[model samples]
Target: MASYWRTPKPGRKIPFIKKSPVENPIMEPSIPTHFRCPISLDLMKDPVTVSTGITYDRHSIETWFEVGNQTCPVTNNVLKSEELIPNHSLRRMIQDWCVANRSLGIERIPTPRIPVTPIQVSELLSEIASASRRGDRARCRELVAKIKALGRESERNWRCIVSGGAGRVLSASFSELAAGSFDNSTSGVLEEILSALAACFPLDEEAHWHIGSPESLNSLVLILNCGDLAGRLNAVLMLKELVSSLDADRINVVADTDGLIEALVKLIEKPISPQTTKASLVTTFYLASSSEMTAVKFVEMGLVSLLLEILVDSDKSMCEKALAVLDGVLESKKGRETASDHSLAVPVLVKKMFRVSDMATGFAVSALWKLCKNYEQERGEGCLVEALQVGAFQKLLLLLQVGCTGTTKEKASELLKLLNGMRGRGECIETVDFKALKRPF
Candidate 1:
């Protein structure tokens, strides 16, 4: 250590010590440089050495890799591997330092469990795969249980299992099990696989395809129908991710699955939780948007009525999602007929306008436009009249004045024209000066 002093000053030049540079003369404990994570600057609880020989907290380094950085944070060298080796010796020293500084309010870092390794994850996956081949359901379930536990340990372990191809392995097992018609004995194992599989999301492209395959779709259907709440929740969320990536042919295959639409509607009709309801709504929206046949099926299932019911009572997030699903449903003529027929649909949707968020208002206005456009050809037909009677006309006027996207503004303007049509011949739109008010848009 070098001896140094504060620059000679008017009064005193205090000598510097090896410690306490970062602390004040008022006597706070100084933290050592190596004890902190470079990224977070907090004490490193579970330090590991990266491929570049730089040590970091395990979580800190995993986050670094997760964000698409392959280079060392310190030296800027490209990392050859993502392996994280536990620095047990340094961790012990950190614990000891904390214990010695306990009087200064430092807490000891707990000893960390060994993180799952790629080879270990691969071996378990292999064992599970082999057991499935041998038709040893017990062994396969036990192995999946192990993977599920490891996945629960840390995001680092989940990354290990994901990169090692657990998604394909688990989906294949679930597909085969599901093919047996979903007996009582298989429920536990199926749930285990889904729990583990969902944790690996943001999966590799190959894994995504595996999960979205026709066989896996059957498994998802069975889970949605008879499996428990957690299982159904996982199924719908998985379907939401899967549907977006599927081509038109594959989505048509999805829409064609017998009893699939029924199960989804049941989930929405009898929502297990807000999360489950939201996931099913989003999944249904994607399917309905992708296929006209699917949209017709949902309309037949009274999805519009259910969504309007939700809009009348649900929370903000629920209302927004329900409105979005409603808008998608109205894309079909049958959906518009059902919505316009329902006693509360027009009023519920009109109630949402200018009240929730801009998105909700947009969806509400879009939906009204669809119904209005449907009945616009029939002058005395009541869709536009019904909307205006619920104060939708005033809300649309306010929405346009508040400012919106070009598309929404256009929709609002068109909706205004439609609602104004129900006015009497003497009570025309010209009575209210259209361009007199300043429109921010």
Candidate 2:
């Protein structure tokens, strides 16, 4: 069926644009040399003139500043002020060029947006606070939408909103929703509030506490259980930030909260995007490291088997996170026993070392040392034989040769001693002994 879009004026004729079933081919047009950003060397989408009078792509120059570079990328001149003025004239010319080449599939650039000042964001937050005190949910949500729009505009706007205390204010608005205000009509507001909070990261310490509140966390758990994929992803992301900000005691409080553990485990059991999966993994690590009870709770929830599954089939990024979470889980007795009982636990942990990353290898070694060392004491030489069967000794040896962190090297050495003793393979703890072991056994 053909489709048509109407103009905003009801009396205007409808234009037939027949939505193409497939994407239009994007072609590279010869952009004018002056249209290119000095830093990025690409046709600028959002050109902004910096303090040094050099025009660059907004995102590219912002990145340069973000990495602690205060001088102009082109001139090497020290920036006197960090202000970014939109190069509206250049941007308009770029857009005109794009439109002129529209037949070649070039899309017009969007108008550049100016980031709100900290003062403006602060005033908006004050309005939300007043709405909250007045119990005005409708007005509160409207103000939150405006903030959300600002965040979606650009990274600079988001930084302004976050530094201006959007995380604190939005979380407060969410707390109000958590107090029995959730319903079909308010789910939009719920997701908007949570999504906005997810963007306000690297939050101040005071903002962290407000977002990690008991009521706020419980509400997130509810979203994790039944919310749509987008909402659930946002919930897990917000939880990751919340957990990252918490200490052991605060983490313990989150762990003891009803339904939170199960909800987080479900996030992993059913994979969303890699992002949500990673966030859930991080959130669980904080929970497991809080106390033995929480770790046991994760083990009881079948988290051990799930993490092992992740280790077996996931990519390097996921494997690294799964290993870290697994290492944290092994701090508890049940966590260790559960892992030891799983057939893939030892072999998979050995397989990950020297392949993923230094951090991953560190977690893998720690988890293996705990599992095998504990089993050596409790289940006799059986675990040692299993480690040898999976070539744990060779992998650990190679790990040390390739270099690892201090703690990983220490754990790898101890595991090597145990495995070498099992195989009648002789080697001391030092690096030279590992090199000498290549001559038969």
lDDT of 2 by residue, 180-296 (tens): 556754566677788787777766777677667776777778888878899999988887887787889888887888899999898899887889999999999888988989999
* Runs in model 1 lying further than 4 Å from the true structure: 1-28, 32-34, 37-41, 49-55, 61-85, 203-205, 212-215, 376-380, 425-441
TM-score of 1: 0.83
RMSD of each: 9.6, 11.9
Q: List the global CA lDDT of all models.
A: 0.79, 0.80
Candidate closest to the true structure, highest lDDT: 2
**lDDT against true structure, model 2:** 0.80
- Model 1 Cα lDDT, one tens digit per residue, 170-268: 877776666565666677777777887878665566666667666677778888988888989888888877777778777777778778899899999
Cα misplacement distance, residue 29 of candidate 2 (Å): 13
Listed in order, each prediction's TM-score against the native is 0.83, 0.75
lDDT for position 371 in model 2? 83
